[model samples]
Target: MDTECMHINATLAKSGYDIRVFGVGHYCFNLIHATAIFCLLLSLSSAVGVIILLCKSRTGKSFMTWHKHERFLLYRCICDISYGFVHTLDHAHILITKDHVGPSGLCALYALLIVNTCLSEGLFSLTSALNAFLSVYFRKNVNFGNKDWKLLLLLGIGPFLIAVLVCSLGVLGPNGFFCAFDSVKGVIANAVMSTGMTSAILVALFTFYVLTWYRIYTETKKLKTQLSNNGCARSATLKSAKAMCLFVVVYIIQWTPLSIYGTWQLISDVPFGLFLAVVIMTNLSGVFSGTICLFNKSNKISVSNKDLGERTGHERKS
Candidate 1:
C-alpha cells in the first residue's frame, strides 16, 4: 500500500462505501463471504478431480498420447484455480480485517490476479469456441508440439501482460466486493478493457458455435433423408447440438450481468440485486468451466480417445 492509496481509501470512505467492511457497500457482509468460500471449495474439488484423472491416465504412458481436449481442459482448469485462489484469499482478508488491511500489497495483488484470470478466462472461452468449430467442421485438433508454447503465449501470458499494464496505470483500489479500479480513470479503463473486450468475445463465441451446430443440422438432414422415407432426425445428434449450446449459454449468463454491472458502476451505485448477480457470476465461473471440462466428451462430429490417438484421418489439415 502506498501513501497515495491510503489517502484515496480515506476519500473513498466518505464517498459511499461503508469502508469499515472493506468497501462492501450495503451488501450483507456474511453472505458475500459465505459465497466466496463456496466458490473456492467448488473450484478446488473440480481441480482435484481433474488432476487425479490426468495423473492416473499418465501412469506408465507418455503425455503426448493424450487426446488434445484433455490438455485444453487442463489448461482451462488452471484458470479456474486462479479464480478460486483470488476469491478465497483476497476476499477472506478483506472480510476478516474489516477494511483494515493496508495501502497494502493485498488489494494490489488481488486486482492483478482477478483481472488476469478474468481476461484469460474470456480468451479461453474463445479457444473453446474455436475448438468446437474445428472439431465439427474439420474433424481434427491441432497439435502445437513440445510445450504448447503457442497456446501458452495466448492463454498463459497474454492477459497477464495486459493486466500488468492496467495495474501500472494506478487505477487499483476497493470496488464493492474486491479491490479493482475505483478511481474514475480506473473505472473507464475497466469499461473499455474488461467489459468491452468481453462483449466482443461473446459475439465471436456465438458466431462460431452457431456455425458448428448449423453444420451438424444441415448435413444430418441431407444424409439421413436418403436412408428413410420418414426423414427422421437423429436423437443423439440433436442432443449433442443442444449440449454444444449449453457452453455458450453458460459463458453468456456468467459474464453478461457482470459486464453490465461494470458499465453501471461507472455512473452510480449499483443495486444489491445487480451487485449479487455480478458477484455470483464472477466467482462461480470456476465451477461452471470445470464442470464443462470434466463431462464434455467426444461426440458425433468430434473425436474420441480411439480416434484421438490415431496419427491422421479426417477432412481436417491438423
Candidate 2:
C-alpha cells in the first residue's frame, strides 16, 4: 500500500498539472472551502435539532401533531447532515494530505455516501411537495399512515441500493483527485444519474406545487365551512403550502445548475465559471436548508400555538 501511494504521488508530481482538490484558482479555493465548513456546521446543527424533535415526538399522538410537510423536512435534515459530514471529511483529507487524490478506500466511500445523500435530498423535496398537494386537495380525507411507510422505504432503501449497484459496477468511483460519479472517469455515469434523478424531482416538484396552490385557491370558499369557523385547518394548510414553495425554490437554486452542468459535461467540457457555480451552489445547499427550515419551524410553532389557544377559548364559550 505504501509503495502504491508513493508511485501515485510520484506520477502526479511528474505530471505538469498540480493535483488540486477544489481544482480551481487560489481565490476560488478559499471561497469554496470556507463555504464548505460553514455548511457542515449549519447542517449538523439543524440535523441534531430535528433529531431531538423526532425523539420527543415518538409517541403516535405527538408524531401526528406535526404538520405532514414537517416529516419530509426531517428527511432533508438527515440528508444534509450526512452530506455535510462526508463533505467536510473529504475537504479535510485533501488539505491534510495536500494531495487532490485521497486514499482509494476513502474516495470510494465518499462517492457512495455522496450519491446516497444527494438522492435522498431530492426525494425528500419531492415528498414535501406531494404532502403539500395532498393537504390542500384532500384535506380531511387524506391519511398518510399507510402510505408513509412506502414512501419511507423508497427514500431510505432505494438510494442505498442504487449507490451499491453503481459502486459495484465500478461506474461510480473516485476521480484522480476527488470522488465523483461524473465524467472524470471518462464515463457518463455521473451525467446520467444526476440528470435522471434531478429531472424527475424537478418535474414532480413543479407539477405538485402548481396543483397544490390551485387546489388551495379553489377551496377558498369551502375552507370556512370545512374548518368549523376556527380557521386552524385553513391556516395549517397555507403554512404547509408556503413551506413546500420555499423548499422547491431552495431545491432549484441549489441543484439545477449542477444538474444542467453535469448533463452538459457529458457532451462537452464545462467552462470554469460554470464549474465554480456548481461547486458554490452545491455546497450552499445545507446553508439554505438549515436557514429556511429553522425560520419556518418557528413560524409554524407560533401559529399552531395561537390556533390552539383560540380554539380552546371558543370551546369554553360554547
Candidate 3:
C-alpha cells in the first residue's frame, strides 16, 4: 500500500511538472499538430492567391473601379489571410512545445494570438460597416454626407474599440500552455477574449444581414415597379440585387455554424478537439467567401475586359 501511494504521488508530480501532459491526450496533441500544418498550408496558398490577385489587378484596367463594398470585402479577405499566417505560427509553436518548455516562448506565442485575434475581428467589423454603407448607397433616395461618413466610421470603429478595451482589461491575452496566468486568470482571459470577440462578430453579422436583406427587398420592389417602364435597367438592377443576395446568403451559411460552435464553446467546457474543429471550420468561411467572390461571373468579365484593354493600351504605347 505504501509503495502504491508513493508511485501515485510520483505520477502526480510528473504530471504537474510536464507541460505536455497537462490533461492533453495524444489525440489532442495530434490534432493540434495537424491544425497547425493545415493553417500553414492555407497561409501559403493564400499568399499565392494574393500575388495572383495583385498581378491581375495591375494588368487589368477594369479591375480598378471596385465598388465600395467590393473594396471592403477585398480588404477583409486580405486580413483573413494575414491572420491565418499568424495562427500558423502559433500552432507551430504549440506543436513544438508539446512538453512545457518555458514561460518566455509561450508568452510570446500568446501575445501573437492576441494580436491576430484583434486584427481579424477588427477587419470583420469593418466589413459589416461597409455592408451597411452599401445598403444605404443602394437606396435611390439616400444621399451621402458628413453625417453618413461619421456614422460609417463609428460603426467600423466601435467593435474594434471594444476589443481593445477587453484586451486592456487582460481578458484577451492567451490560453492553454502558453498562457502566462494561473488557472483562474487563464479562464477569465479566455472567457473575456471569446465572449468579447464573438459578441462583436455576432453583432456585426446581424447588422449586416438585416441591412442587406432590407436592401435586397427594396431593390426587388423597385425593379418590379420599373419593369414596365424600363425593362433593361430593371433587369440590370435585378441581376445586381440577386448577385448581392446570393453572396450574403452564402456568406451567412458558411459562417453561422462556426459562430454557433464558438459561442457554445465560449459558454461551455467543451473538449479541446471540438474547439479545434470549430476553429478550422471557422477559418474556412473566409476561404469559401473569397473563392466565390473572386470567381463570380461579373468579376471575371470585368477582369477579362480590363485585361484586354490593358494589353491594347500597352501595344499602343509600344
Cα displacement (Å) at residue 184, model 3:
3.7
TM-score of 3: 0.62
Runs in model 3 deviating more than 4 A are 1-25, 57-64, 100-126, 129-174, 177-183, 214-218, 221-259, 262-268, 271-273, 298-318
Please, what is the TM-score per model?
0.76, 0.73, 0.62
- Pairs with steric clashes in candidate 1: 1-103, 1-104
Task: Write one digit per residue (lDDT tens) for candidate 2, span 186-262.
Answer: 24676567776687787788888788777767666566566474465466556556666677778877888877776
Cα displacement (Å) at residue 300, model 3: 5.4
Question: Which order, best to worst by TM-score?
Answer: 1, 2, 3
Of candidates 3 and 2, the better by lDDT: 2
Runs of candidate 1 exceeding 4 Å displacement: 1-27, 135-145, 183-185, 222-249, 263-269, 297-318
Clashes in each model (backbone N, CA, C under 3 Å)?
Answer: 2, 0, 0
Among the numbered candidates, top lDDT falls to 1
Candidate RMSDs in order = 6.4, 6.9, 8.6
- Writing each residue's lDDT as its tens digit, candidate 1 over 81-172 gives 87787768777777776563356466777878888887887876776667556655675544445667777788768989988888887776
Sort the predicted structures by lDDT, highest score first: 1, 2, 3
Please tell me which predicted candidate would have the highest TM-score against the true structure: 1
